[model samples]
Target chain A: MVLVAIILSACAPGTPDEDSWRVDALRSIGDVSSSVSSVQLALQHHDRLFGPYLQTVAVQAEDAAGTASTKLSAVQPPEPYQGRSDTVTSALDDAESLLTDARIAVVRRDSAAYADLVRRLKRTGDRLSRIEDRIRALPDDRSRP
Target chain B: MKKLLNVALGVLTAIGGFVDIGDLVTNAQVGARFGLSLAWVTLLGVVGIIVFAEMSGRIAAVSGRATFDLVRERLGPAMGMANLLGSMGVTLLTYVAEIGGVALAFQLICGVDYLLLFPFVGALVWLVLWRAKFSVIENLFGLLGLALIVFVVALLKLGPDWSQLGHSAVSFQPPKPEAWSTWAYYAVALFGAAMTPYEVFFFSSGGVEEKWGVKDIGVMRTNVLLGFPLGGVLSVAIAACTYVVFNPLSASVDTLGQVGLPVAIALGKIGLAIALLGFVAATFGAACETGLSTGYSIAQYFGWQWGKFVRTDVAARFHLVLLLSTVIALGVLATGIDPVQVTEASVVFSALALPLTYFPILVVANDRDYMGEHVNGRVLNVLAMFFMVVLTVVALAAIPLMIWTRMGA
Candidate 1:
């Protein structure tokens, strides 16, 4: 009885006409939700398209390095390229793999695994972010321009 | 002299209570969405918090027991346990959300992803809980969180139309095209954010922690009366900033970065940086509060000694629960779930669970056995009863509204 009364009471009248603002706010919310959904989709694509290839590269890189110095030197490039190309490729591959795992988690709606994969992907993203930062920090003469 | 000190304590608790992650998001979200139409909710919440907080504080002062402690004694174990479970679950979820919030704020400022910051933020919270003196940890973050005043400065910089804002707040019709469900959902969300279970648990627990006796009743009263409303002002400032900035852009705040954007626009990077610091402090402070309250409720329920006043070795189980709660929160954040979404859900869940925690406190406050001479007078009872009715209604409507609005779309 009291519960019914409570429910009815909460049905109080709301704010008056501001239809335009309401549509605008709802649309804005929809756009943000769509953006988030899109990001999730992109992450899925990264995993499916690039994940296995990266794992193969990682294995090959491991095989190429019979010794510590050889492994380091093989991964390293010339003066112009430095060690960045290999690092960038490897990192991107790792990110794509993580994204793939994240996509699987998302499919399963596993909040825990989805969170973990997102964390892993974020780390990969951070590595990329740092590479960009370092590249930007370099003198203009070193740039393509 | 003691009277003055009590007033100061009230102010500090109110400050501590005002700026949880829910307030950070809800105030900003509503401000962005409806301008100040919902600003009145914050005021209403302040009044609600004050009324209930005073009652709980007075109950503690007179009975020499915190809110939950009396809840068990008065309501008996079964009902109290139900309240305990509901309140504790909501509080724990809130703790997880706040820890995530702090990490997200760090990500915003440092250009690091929030997950990377999760372990470190978790460790920092644990370190504070483990080592820092209770009063010091409480005062440090509670006081430092005042940096959130940057929001107020940003609001001033934005220069909103005050009369228009006042009209929106005073005019209570559901704005056009907004499904009544969505409006009510956000309304319930705002209400839940304002009267989160942790606030009462923390407030009542703080009263007990500070050793409030019957003589301390006046001090407790003043704290509830003044501090909460002041905190509401900060919430208003956040919402108003969003109203002025995001409303024009029609930007919905889905991230901590967006929440801080108005500050960034108004005061530039420096303001954004400080506001982020405030966000970190406020959320981290709340994390600690919820974490501690998790252990406090359990310990108090079973007749175990609890609180920061005791040493780690003496309160082994209490410390253990606190440690585990922080670990779980860290784990949740590491999963990379969006903290903002978690905070939204936490506030909604808190809204649904409101009556469980609050009704008991109201009942206890009016009990002659518990409150004695300090029992709620006629006026306080009337006000408390009214808000109780309000809270119960919001709780019931919260879930259906969420589903209907698709979590407010």
Candidate 2:
């Protein structure tokens, strides 16, 4: 029974389940979050080849974050949950804007601008992380005893 | 039956060369993003490795020489040096990645940081290289690598849509959103992982280690014909596992733990146990293989006697290269670089280094003086030469595509 439920959940596609869209939306943001941090790791390691291509990474990351935010916002939520969804979308907005700044700073090798953006990116990352935890803890539709 | 079983070297090379750490991660990453669309690259790589491994193995059997040895004799000193430098550079990079890969695999089970496990893994690799007999090393890890078969079972249990997978395999486009560059980059990485230069160096060198003669040619053919393709299947199964589990969620696999998630989901803890065993065995086995190949390439290039079969006292240069390569690998990992990144770079670099070792081997294989009657026939030569072109194109495209895709994002 447990295995079947797991399999069914895995196979379900864009169902009308209350948390379905948010779960997928939040997870996509998490993927982008993971990719962004990997880029940061590459830079932190002073990886000359991949890390230094900051403009390209920032542009790409910005586009992904922007698109993810758009998608997350497009998903209609129940009235009571609208604020939480907006909070998540707002985090993505901050990420997208900072990534844009990161691109220019990275291109100029402007340490001050890049440092400022990094600070903002960290805060936005923290909020998105909190939102992800909240969304994951949302009750599974069928899990209610 | 016994002669067929003599394919231990081939099987060992398959486990390490064909489906090592680089292949495991790259295949899963591709599958998550591209589905089985890149499956054809794995197939192409399988055929390419068989052709070259057969030639190199035949050269060792007929000429009593390994690849680097004949590379110098046929291509002369300058070209040999270039080959040595290119091949050894990638081999050493691969050595570092393989050691780090083993550490990563062990980390999956023990929860220790891979950097901390480097010393133990490196020590174990060196110990096996130093103390274990050739056949013992080959058979032990090779058979254990069969544990990766858990992937096949998990895939079947997952019951993926076979027709959908087949359709993805036939389509040439990137799944969506991802550009042609990411697809092309991974294609080259997959190709490079499949036909990694160290595999040829290790395979030919292992042939020499076992002291194969022309009579052993049949066994070599069996290994190439049978053992290698099976290894490619292991690669595909890994990709399919990811495609089934992660593709739906749009989740990309960036870590080894996630690679095994589908197996656990399908077969529970027992499956996880077996997959982890496979990971350790495959990565540990490759570490030993690559650590030795580092020695093999340098020793063979300089005309210094080298082989695990030979005493360390007699092959001091070879053993020293092994020790130095291990230390260098440990140094790189200690810098806290991601082994997964090293794994990605190693495969792409292998694509770049392919032409260096391959061109000379093709020249040597056709030389009647070296192979006697075992020379490549006209048909096989045409096929081998064609794949050489394929390898060259992959070499040229690997770096640019990696950059354009930001290392596949």
Candidate 3:
């Protein structure tokens, strides 16, 4: 419930412009965040069956992040938000790359790698959230009817 | 004194063996979504299975015929074939799910894909079925399966508000945003998991496999009466822990990792280690039972030489079916389908197959030719008939409710 609200309130501008790249970018960021956090929670408790559970979500995160990155790659941002959109897409790609690394670390029980990946995951998540915040601050896309 | 010890061990094994992948996963899922509101279904399932297990056990002890044998004798070949096919199909589906469950549990420990473990799990199960003495298999896994009690220990460690959880248990009202259909759907799933037909098939066939006679009825009754209700407590414990952790977040449990999270959150590392052990033992133990039950139902229906009492060569057809079924289970699980989803479908389908599997037990237990003086007495008759109605409703509504809820979303 908390996660859902975080994603929705972060992604929605009063109404998004049909062409608003910010909305698409923010939504992708939210998706990556949700998937990363789920994997992160499983990892923090990494010494147990959560590893197997991580194995389950690891595959899902891989698929979801792939789609999110592909969608973000297609987005051409609006005038003021173009730079923010580029950063968001780059952060998303990094996050996706890290999730794959985390799955391998989790499977291999590479605690050092798991530790490093988790730190990177947090930085990536924070980056996504900050971009979402900036997108949330933008005024409603006035072009939508 | 020796007989008393034997009875005690039997009951303990039953208690330990009762929680399988279906119970572990379904109970945790329901608890997260509905809190204690649906706990009654697990309890109801316990009492229901006990009532019928005693009857089936009685039939096996008195007549020395396992379930499908009498099912064929009483229900006739044609209708009995329908029963056999329905029950065996779901039982095979459940068999595949149990193999996947064991693989899932192993994955938790090693951080590997469950599919990678399927062949070894299936091969180990078949090897055990082929060579292990029946009593050794029954007692070993069932006893190890008791590691599931970690859920109860974790629940106490979590120290939830009992009065609030108790109120939800009493009210039977689902939390907001959950509709009645979804609740009813899980209720059926719980029912199917608890009273799953294979447990009985394994129980009665196990009675015959161990050569239970009138001499063993006392032991069998003691196990069902005392063991099953205690097993129900472990099922509730899984739900209680999940409710404490995931309910507030409105999280629906989808992964085995989520199921063990509450345990880790409560007791941390050591608790999770034990819970993972529980996961492996419960699922592996059930894999053996369901795998055997698959072979038991088919062999008995055809009147083939069966039971571990005979040499493998003497029971060649039975052993062959067991081999083929293991391969089939391996094939199904190797397809990359989720075992958790398979468990949900198996239990719901088990609900659909319940009456077919059980109605003959009720009939055979009552028949003078089969049971003689061992037939159900008056009070037991009243209770059995009442549950028949309840199980009938559960069976009729299971499919529609599953479809309406889209497998509980």
Candidate 4:
């Protein structure tokens, strides 16, 4: 019963206070960052990777990024933290878009586009990582209920 | 020489069949996040499993009965029901995940979506369970799963700093950026993955299916003692492979493809192809085992005739349970659930189910009625008692840790 209650409360939608909002936002960022880095790694070894394996990895990355974007978007951030939430969500959007492009390149087996896609993915991934670090460094002003 | 060959085969199969989808995903995820810091959990879990499995095998050998059959007789129907519910529940969940895992493996190989392949994977697993002989199902997939040895080869090819890996293995502390709760959560997951209930259920039941008596105890002991540690080595090799490749990048393994990526990085296309084969065999093998385990637990509890040693027609209800389980598992997967998520849940719940499944074995093993002169000795009793405490602690901690860590978010 306690487990069910905790899970139910977690699923209930409410505007999280600043600290929890930051934690949720950073989790989304971390997920997208991991997905983006997966694509970068897969693309770097595309020649050695099987075509189907490459496609599967790329598609999973895109799905993960898409899910992170949707999850972060669903979070009703408290008024003061709305800007930070939007920034993280926007970064996720970019990551999702890059992942989609990477997936297409992988499906088409376009070696020529691989280099640029890897570069873009790494840059976006690095940006997401930096965002996570910044959020981690932020002071937890648990002022709002 | 024939007897020697039989022992050799049993050991080889045990080593190959040791890893299932849970071990594959959890070990890779831990290695990626914590390096070798959690390696001790896998070792601890392996020893725990070996202790119980040997006792269960001994029970089967001496009593001419499987674990669940003896569980009900020794512990009474009420406690047997409790064990059945916990162990069978996780085994069924694991059954679904292993079928889906096979589809995922096929998807990686053929570029088809796993959803498209689920029905076929489900049917194929059912067909094998229904048609294959006990030893054939055990040996074919187990030997094929030896392809996972590529992980050992992959780790060597990666040329990791041995001293650094040894240091992490001994660290016992979580690495930077990991909290103790998160480390503890993964530790429980690793233990759960290493010592899932189905393995023992399958082992004890398989002994019955093969019609083992006292003479076969030597072969069983050889397999458990020699085979399981080697299998543990393979588990650590998988972690070390991912640790060498993904740890430096601070990435996590969230997909099946990522679990096999380290092999591609180290040994190129052929190695990747071999790893994919390993995935298919390991998951498919476990799918068969867990599927049978579900039937074994229920039929044995209900006093229905069970075991592949009997004709399918003779053990009608047991076969029916296997068929229904496959259809239900497929039904669950048809709703488009993520197999990896199912795999994760199965391991955690497997931890929760550990004591329920294991305590009965310890009790029955000590009962002189079942083991005339073969009751657990003082030394073995001390060891098993220690593990019982550990299992109880792990079982109690599993859900709370899962909740607190938000499933190791």
Best by DockQ: 4
How much lDDT does candidate 1 score? 0.70
- Lowest summed lDDT across 10 adjacent residues in model 1 chain B is found at B248-257
| lDDT (CA) per prediction | 0.70, 0.78, 0.82, 0.91
Q: Could you give candidate 2's per-residue lDDT for residues B1-409 as a string of tens digits?
A: 6654556656655544457888888998899889999999999999999999899999999988899898898889999999998888898898899899898787666655577888999998998898899877776787788889899999998899999998998997898756687789899999989988988888898889989999989878887888899899989999999898777755577766667767766776677789888999888888888899889988888899789888889988888888888999999989988788899989988998898879999999999888878889999999998998998898877766665554665
Candidate 2: residue pairs that collide? none
lDDT of 2 by residue, A55-129 (tens): 434544565566667776677766556666666667777667767767666667665565456556666666666
lDDT of 1 by residue, A61-104 (tens): 22212221232223323355434445544544454454445545
Worst 10 residues of 2 chain B by lDDT: B9-18
Best prediction by lDDT: 4
Show the lowest summed lDDT stretch of 10 residues, model 4 chain B.
Answer: B400-409
User: What is the Cα-based lDDT of residue B179 in candidate 4?
Assistant: 88
Reported per model, the fraction of native interface contacts reproduced equals: 0.00, 0.04, 0.24, 0.67
TM-score of each model, paired residue for residue: 0.75, 0.77, 0.82, 0.97
Better of 2 and 3 by DockQ: 3
Q: DockQ values for all predictions?
A: 0.02, 0.04, 0.15, 0.61
Report the C-alpha lDDT of model 3 over B1-409, residue by residue, as the tens digit.
9999888889878988899999989999898889999999998999999999999999989998898899898979997898888888888999998999888778777766777888999999999999999988789888887877888989998899999999999988778757789899999999999998999999999999888999889989999999999999999999999898877644466667678888887787788888888888888888889888988998999999987889999999999999999999888887878788899999998998888888888988889988888889999999998998988999888877775655775
Best by TM-score: 4
Instruction: After superposing candidate 3 on the true structure, give the runs of residues whose Cα lies further than 4 Å from its correct spot.
Output: A1-40, A44-145
Clashes of 2: 0
Better of 1 and 3 by DockQ: 3
The candidate, 3 or 4, that scores higher on DockQ is 4
Q: Encode model 4's per-residue lDDT on B1-409: one tens digit a residue.
A: 9989998999889998999999999999999999999999999999999999999999999999999888998889999999999899899999999999999999999989999999999999999999999988999999999899999999999899999999999999999888899999999999999999999999999999888899999989999999899999999999999998888877888889999999998999999989998999999999999999999999999999998999999999999999999999999999999999999989988988999999999999999988989899999999999998988999888888887777887
